[model samples]
Target: MKKKITVILKKNLVNLGSVGSIVKVSSGYAFNYLIPYNFAQLATVGRVRHYNMFLSIKQKKLNEIQSKLQIISQKLNKITKISVKKKIGNNNQIFGSVSDKEIILNLFDITGEKLDKKHLYFPDIKKIGIYNLDITLASDIKLNIKLQILPAFI
Candidate 1:
């Protein structure tokens, strides 16, 4: 017979803590993944007895990280203005339309944030103008950005 257990999560678990919250899970999985790896601990009577201490430490750490993330989010929330330079023909059409990979690289060059090309919302940008884009930063954070497209200087 296998026994189940609850644990105080010290970090992000599949469906657990925002850093430090308690949740219930299977004993074997908890022992194998949570305990050994130190991501969580058994919510035994003794551990629960000292839950306050655990919570205090975890909350302090989470508070600090939240502060830093808030700052980063502020910067991210500010609309990012990016200008793309492309080669164009007679009809203002790019010989080769700009790609998300190119835009991602340019974003990295400007902001130092490593964003995947898939995150850019635009399917294909073939003309010059201001466009809005959405970037998924992990499961919890998403960002919006703008790009200013222009023809490349010959």
Candidate 2:
């Protein structure tokens, strides 16, 4: 019978496994190549415990971020309308078309929260008028807020 030993991977390897994963391989491979190259380490009790603790801490951080986003989502949902001011050119036309970056900045100013542009689904905003704004916070969280574009002398 070929002797096999269990080891924890230090880095992801093609055709093997990801980092921190415990895998059993032939003794020769583990001792000769994997151990010598620093690709893996013996899966001791202390190392496994440390990895589990690290995973728990990482999970906690992710949960905190999700909760913070939930609070921001609630605040945004309460918003009924948001207005954007823009420079106007001749014939009362907007000097330049509104962009996603500008909208994100306006949202931050109003809510004091940073938003990613990928969450926005914009409407035609060439002229100044009221338009429906679509923002997707997550797969299940969506918000529709009224947006008004007004002309500014500046």
Candidate 3:
């Protein structure tokens, strides 16, 4: 039986491993592609120790970020509904549809935190009474808010 060669990855490789990870691969593949591309190096005792330390630090930072996002999500959940006034026509149809930009602005006003409009998920709000919007704060964190469309006061 051939022994697998262990390597420490210097960069993230698809289907291989993440950065700072130790993985075992065929010697031919490691020497031909990974080593040549500077994506990984041989897993030495010192390198393995360093990788473990690096992973611990990375995990700590991730936990801090997750905690901060969790606090923001809690604050966002406190908001029951975001009221947006729009011009209404004869049949109670709004003149214009709500956009992500507008929603982000309103969210900032309510939460005092600015969020990227790209993270908001909602359908086309042409004529809305009340709709739910999903806000992705992080890959694992999400918050839902109610959007209340009200008729504009003339």
Candidate 4:
């Protein structure tokens, strides 16, 4: 049975090319994954038309936000100072850990930008001095921030 579907594109669907394109997909796929993963919705005639117009507005808003982020990223990229305090012994191992959440929080306080924790990459940062963080703002937008972690005196 053919059903009207409204798919709210999320994370820039490979096929959709944007974040609000509502296209018709099979009912089974819609119910099984798209809805659950928050990739789409039921595009009734009314909803479809509404979403189409909304898409333009969303694009405009996103463009504006992206432009602002670009300027911020440029400033952040030049930053080369970050200090993370920790308690450690002679072994140079940190008694506590520096989490991505803390990093994001610190960055937010500094840049006025809410950085997503997932976008903060840390393969290994046990004993840190200075590290480079690669953050993804959007599909095409990205930023690099410096993280300086220092050991807190006991």
Candidate 5:
């Protein structure tokens, strides 16, 4: 039976792992095909340390982004309600339904934070009244806020 050896892949291979992934393969395959083609490197102690350092730096950057998003979520939740004005047409219906883009813009105006459409959840708003909005900033940060729709001063 052939011996198995460990390697760190430099590129994605079919039926194999992606780049930066450590995997085990036959010794002959590692020496003849993978290493010669510059597709992978043996997981020496120094190279393993380098990979760990890279992951550490990546984790730090991710933490910083999450903290910023948490702050923005807190700011959004502190407000009791937000008011939006629209021209009340016949039957007290808006010209059209309020969309996610409009809500994101209003939040940006209030909190100075840009919001993505995928993270904001609410019902299709047509008639002007009060409704609830749900915002997800990160995996752990969520917000529920009141939204008040009123007639525009014209």
Candidate 6:
């Protein structure tokens, strides 16, 4: 029976393993491909301990980020509606469409949380009364906000 060598992955490899993961592979494959390319390292006791420590630190940081996102989500949920003013045309249609930038700025004004416009999911508002906006806070957290468009007299 051939003995498999234990290795710790240094980076994520598709179909292989993730970073900091301990896996066993054939010694030839480990030495030729994984180790030579800096993809993995020999999993000695000390290296394993260090990897475990690194994983713990990473998990701690992830938890902190998640908690902060949760707080932001709570604040965003408190906002029930956002009002936007645009010039009305002859047929009650907005002259300019509402875009993600406008929504992001309004959210920052109301909630005091600065969010990337990429996180907002909405269709272009040409003629708007009440529209639903989906804001992705995290993979697991989403916020729904109502958008109200009022006619501006200029």
Q: Model 6: per-residue lDDT, tens digit, 1-154? A: 4569999998999978888789999999999899999999999999999888988999999999999999999999899999999998977799879978888888888888899987899878888599989989789999898999999888
Measured against the true structure, the TM-scores of the candidates, in listed sequence, are: 0.51, 0.74, 0.77, 0.58, 0.78, 0.88
Tens digit per residue, CA lDDT, model 1, 23-53: 8778888988889999997677787768877
Please give, for residues 66-91, the per-residue lDDT of candidate 5 as tens digits.
88987897888777788888888988
**Residue 113's lDDT in candidate 2:** 88
Task: Order the numbered candidates by TM-score, best leading.
Answer: 6, 5, 3, 2, 4, 1
Candidate number with the higher lDDT (1 or 2)? 2
Name the weakest run of 10 consecutive residues (lDDT summed) in model 5: 73-82
8-71: candidate 2 lDDT, tens digit per residue? 9999999789998889999899999999999999888998899899989999998897888799
How does residue 138 of candidate 1 score in lDDT?
46
Which portions of model 5 miss their true places by more than 4 Å? 10-19, 29-39
Q: lDDT of each model, Cα atoms only?
A: 0.75, 0.87, 0.87, 0.72, 0.89, 0.90
Clashing pairs in 2: none
lDDT tens string, model 3, 103-146?
Answer: 88898898998888878998887784999889898988888888
TM-score winner between 4 and 6, please give it: 6
Total backbone collisions for each predicted model: 1, 0, 0, 12, 0, 0
Off by over 4 Å in 4: 1-52
Q: 41-137, model 4: which lDDT tens digit per residue?
A: 6666787688778878989998899898788677667666656777776667776678888787777677777866776776577774777777886
Candidate 3, poorest ten consecutive residues by summed lDDT: 1-10
Off-target runs (Cα >4 Å) in candidate 6 are none
Those runs of model 1 whose alpha carbons end farther than 4 Å from true positions after fitting are: 1-72
